[model samples]
Target: MITIQDIRNAQENIQDTINATPILQSGQLSQLCRNQVFFKCEHLQKTGSFKIRGATNKVKQVVMEGAKLVTAASSGNHGQAVSFIAQQLGVPATIVVPTDVNPCKMNAIDAYDGNIVKCGTTSAERIPRAIEIAAEQNGLFIPPYDDPYIMAGQGTTGLEILEQVQDVDAVIVPIGGGGLISGILTAIKETNPNIKVYGVEPETANDTFLSFQNGRITSITPTSTIADGLRATQPGDMTFPVMQKYLDDLVLVTDEEIRRAFSVVMERMKQIIEPSSAVTVAALMNKKLPLEGKKVVTVISGGNVDLARISELMIGTERIY
Candidate 1:
């Protein structure tokens, strides 16, 4: 289990490499939600996502211990993050991605000079193939999630949230493999147990919510959603336990709701966030929880959406105020 100290050390390890993204008050969203809402703008972080923090910490730790190469699997953000960090550290990186990965992320990985391998479009296929490649090349495997270092590194966001909003009443985070939420929940609940933590997922990919409700890890048939980053079929083994123990609630949103939220942020918050990031905002706008009049923080986890697809997502959806 990753402890708070591990998270602190991770913060120190990657402090110079990663930016401490700002937590800005979203007056428009606050008024709409009838609460004081703050946005943790992780979308502004390097590589346009918070994945860089964990990727950098993991790569740096291994490189310092004589690692020459590393490999990882990502749908998009994690691949870009690992490749970018590895390039900075002068370590060779190979990234295995799903066959249908977003082109923007693929281009970013190429820009960072990370070797790309396309495999079947599922974590089951991508993870095994990545590990096989790492073994064949005598390189380290940096998991997208399910590792202590990755979780601890991601926990730094929670530390920032607590520092930035001292009296935060609640935090809403999007759930994928549960890495980000696991880290955040650990940091927030350990530091101040009274602060409520909620995890949100697209209705099409609600594995984490199912796991939370079942009292054990559960998986669903692979499904697709606009929030590609949150499409993991199941919660990670390491991350599930932490979420089960710390999350105050788990909520689900539809692709329609995510689209509306995406439009809302772009128009009102003046931020172009990815669909996964919009999940948090969707939760708030849809009133998934009883947060009226409370001080809420929503983590906008990334901004790496393919610009070519934004128009299609917003074409028919009516943006709710």
Candidate 2:
């Protein structure tokens, strides 16, 4: 189990390496929701996502232990984060990704000089392939969301949120394999148990939601959504229990709702966030959570988007006025 001390140590471990992202109040959203809305701008974080904190922390630990090579599997963001951080730390890295991963993320991994290996279109395929490669190369395997180090590293964001927003009544975060929310839940609940932490996910990729509802780890057949980063078939072994223990609620939003949230953030907030990052906002806008007259923090998890897809996503959605 992850402890508060582990999160604090992770903060110290990646203090200089990670960005302390700003928490900005969204005036328009506040007016709409009748609550003080603060957005943790993790999209502005290194590698255009919050994955860097965990990736850097894990890489640092392994490299200090004389690890010369590392391997990871990601749909996109985690792959880029692991590759970039490993390259910077002088540890050779290999990243296995699904063939359907976003092109922009693929390009970023290549730019980081990570050896790219392509596999089938699910974690089941990508993970085993990457593990095989890691064994062959005698390298450490860095899972995207399952490791304790990764969870602790991601907890730093929650620490920042607490420092940045006072009297925060609730924090809404998007969930995939449950890493980010797991860390945030640990940090926030351990420090201030009164503060509620809710998780959001695309309706199509609602593994975490089902897991939360069923009182056990549950999985869905992998489905496609605009929130591609949140396509995990199931929650991580380490992350699920943490989430079940601390998460106040789990909400699901449709792809259309996510796209609408993405459009609003881009046009009104002037922020470029990927679909996965927009799910929290989608939950808020759809009133899926109880946020009336409260101070709410929404985590904008990533901004690495393929520009060409924006027009397609926004085609039928009307802008929030």
Candidate 3:
């Protein structure tokens, strides 16, 4: 539903506010995968995630369209992005969160001055609630991943990666609701069809993988993967077609693998990447694909982990020897 030009326009629209997050080379990953590896560090973006890119674009559109307020259903990062951008634009935001929402993300939203509401724990529950609240208040509802404008804004990340990294042959992205990967796929394929785009997901939260295998959107029970940001129950309807058209492959990593990658990034790279951000590296560390002589980039989705849970994260995993 979005064109590359839409993405380019989004780039123009959000550039003023969003950081063109840096791409840093991972020498350890390069040795492990036998290829040059770089990280697109969206964890350093505004609101500590790339969600701001899309959130800024969507909220700006709504404001121009005369929306007095906005509502959204999010587990954490998207809510933070919406709340943060809305605050900057002098608009109010209501975030309907799941009962099991992460405290770190909730605190960020609250800090951004978002109106917080707790609803049922699933998107199936909170999504309807967000729409209902929008209707009740005559406000606009912003979907996390299933909208064209959101995808377009997210695609701007891919554009930056292309500019920052020369002749990249592949990119790996973490998939939650499929918005980020769908956007990256469009940006890469439209710019250079030869650059393969792959997606990684938590094994416990592999709804997008199931969707690809089943040739239709499939739902799963909510998972307890440490990668909370990757716990989407299903792929987006609008995003599915884009994956089918342009995506190269999908892979899954266990929570154990995710932990290993997380610790490695912290201890070696000295970067405190959240678990969801580690899935791409987990795929690489697990040698999920052939990359003996390729240039690859992994999109680190976000870095909003709850510090109170760091001990919990390292419980089952050992430090790198």
Candidate 4:
């Protein structure tokens, strides 16, 4: 289990590399939800996502451990994050991504000067290949989630939330592999047990919710959603238990709802956000939680929406449903 102390240490380790992103009040969203809403603008962080917090901390620790290279598997955010950090530290990185992962994501990895290995079509397949490559080449494996160090690093986001919103009634986070929620829950509940944490996921990609009910990890049959960043097949071993212990609820949103949230963010908040980031907005817009009139904080996870995809989500005639 990761502790608050570990999170504090990570905050210090990666402070210079990562941004203390702004937390902005979303008046439009608040008016719509009839609640006080503050958006943690992590989408504006380095590499355009909060994943860098964990990836940088993980790679920095590995380099101190005398690892010559680092390996990782990601859908998009984590791959870009690890690659960027590895290059910054002058350490080599190899990223194994699912074959069907987005081309824009691949381009981002390519831009970071990281080695890319095309692997299986799911995170389940990609992770094993990362491990294999690490073993074959004597490199360290930087898991997207499931590692104590990674979890602790991600928890620093929660610490920031608490510091910014000491009287927060609820914190909403989007869930994929559960790292973000796990870290936030650990940090928030430790400081204020009264703060409620909600995990939001697409209805088509609700692996963590199912895992919470099953009392074990569960994999979803492969399905596609607009929120590709939240498309993990299952909950991670380390993240599952933390969520089960700390999360107040797991809510599901539809693809349409997610797109609407994307539009709301762009139009109302004047902020560019990706689908995965919009999951937090989607939950509030759909009233998935009982958060009327309460002070709520929503973690805007990323802002890496492909321009073409954004056009399609907002105005294109193609069916996203």
Model 4 lDDT per residue over 184-289, tens place = 9989998888999999999999999888788789999877898888889999888998998898999999998888888877777789888998888889888899
TM-scores for all candidates? 0.98, 0.98, 0.97, 0.96
The per-candidate count of clashes, in order, stands at: 0, 0, 0, 0
Q: Model 1, range 1-321, lDDT digits (tens) per residue?
A: 788888999999999999999987768789988899999999999999999988988899899999899999999899999999999989999999999999999999999999999998778779999999999999999999899999999999999998998799999999999889999999999999999999999999988888877888898987889999988989999999998788899999999889998988887777889999999988999998988999999999999989899887773424475
lDDT of each: 0.91, 0.91, 0.90, 0.88
lDDT of 3: 0.90
Question: Model 3 over residues 211-252: C-alpha lDDT tens digits?
Answer: 999999999986778888877788999999999999899999
Q: Candidate 2, which segments miss by more than 4 Å at Cα? A: 315-321
Q: Model 2: per-residue lDDT, tens digit, 62-129?
A: 99999999999999999999998988888898999999889999999999998999998878778988
lDDT of 1: 0.91
Regions more than 4 Å wrong, model 1: 315-319
TM-score of 4: 0.96
